[model samples]
Target: MLEVGSTLPEVSFGYIKDGKMTDPRTNEIFGDKRVVVFAVPGAFTPTCSQAHLPGYVALADKIKAKGVDTIVCLSVNDAYVMDAWGKASNAEEIMMLADGNGFFTKSIGMDMNTSDFGGTRSVRYSMLVEDGEVVKIFVEDPGRFEVSDAETMLKNL
Candidate 1:
């Protein structure tokens, strides 16, 4: 797993904007910026939909007030699903990013195999990045959601 002081990998995360696909590289998003990034195993899953992403959406303004340039919610789903979920959740202030194939998740060593409940997926985690380097990271254990929530990230900031 990526640790504090580790730079984010060079990879592209897909999303939808204005009805078109946008794939931004990791550096483009994290470089020269303070960003809050959180990842879920899949989009629209129970905990993710009900608590994980919604917490960020509710606290986005406060998080950005602490000099965070962006708040990203990432998942191992397609752009279409992520976009839809963002809209459904009223997450206009958050960036909904799609891993699509778990490439970025695997590259960061946060990938897990579930066998039945969606195959390869990313474990739940949240991080604070500054100028492309991780300054703080909170990774949740299997089936747990304690340390990686928005309130925790906000308090840490």
Candidate 2:
């Protein structure tokens, strides 16, 4: 698992931004920026939809006020699903990123799969990264949610 103070892995994946397909690495999305990146097992899942993304949306202003540049919500789904979920959840302040192949999640050593889910997915995790280095992490236990809430992340900031 990636630990605090570790340099974040160099990973990139496709995502939908403003209805356009984008590659984050090519865009240098995290370079020289203070970022809050959170991942969930899947898009539109119950806890992730009701709590995780909304928590970040509700705290978007406050997070920006604290000097954070972006709050990103990543999932193992494709860009279309991520875009749809963002629209449905009204996650205006959060950038919904798609790690379609679990590349980013696996690079960070946070990929897992539940017995029932039957596929590799990102564990519920949140990290505060500064210039591509991790400053803090909040990783939820498998099958558990809530520890990585935006409120807690804001408090940490």
Candidate 3:
């Protein structure tokens, strides 16, 4: 796993803005900014939909108030699915990023082979990045959601 002080890997995550798909460079997103990146194993799954994402949604303002320039919620799903989820969850503050190809996840050494669940996916984790460098990271154990919750990250911040 990428540790604290490591520079974020160069990758592009699909972004859906104004119903148009765009590829946003990871470095540009994190450049000279304090950003929070949270990865989920899959979107709309039980723990993810009911708890994980909501925790962040509930605390988005608080996290940003602590100097976070942006908050990103990442999953292996594509741009369209992510857009629908962002709307369904009312997560206007979070930039739902689609790592459809898992390139970013693999680069960070967080990719998991969840072929049984359909395909490759990222493990649940979160990192606090400042100016494109990681300052803090929390990776959850399989089938768990403890340390990476928004409340936990907020406390750290």
What's the TM-score of each model vs. the native?
0.98, 0.94, 0.98
In terms of lDDT, which candidate is strongest?
1
Error of 1 at 63 (Å): 0.4
Pairs in steric clash, model 1: none
| lDDT score at residue 29, model 1, on the 0-100 scale | 88
Stretches of candidate 1 exceeding 4 Å from the true structure: none
Ten-residue stretch with the least lDDT total in model 2: 22-31
TM-score of 1: 0.98
Q: Write the per-residue lDDT of candidate 1 for residues 36-80, one digit (tens) a residue.
A: 999999888999999999999999999999999999999989999
Q: Which TM-score value belongs to model 3?
A: 0.98
Report the lDDT tens digits of candidate 3 across residue range 10-114.
888899998899999987799999999899988888888999889999999999999999999999999898889989999999999999999989998999998
Q: Can you write out model 2's per-residue Cα lDDT over 1-157, one digit (the tens) per residue?
A: 8899888767787778778998787137677999999899989999999899989988999998999998899999998999999999999888888899888888888889755774888999898988988899999987787679899899999
Query: Which residue pairs in model 2 clash with each other?
Result: none
1 or 2, greater by TM-score? 1
Prediction 1 global C-alpha lDDT: 0.95
How much is the lDDT of residue 100 in candidate 2?
Answer: 90
Residue 120's lDDT within candidate 2 is 86
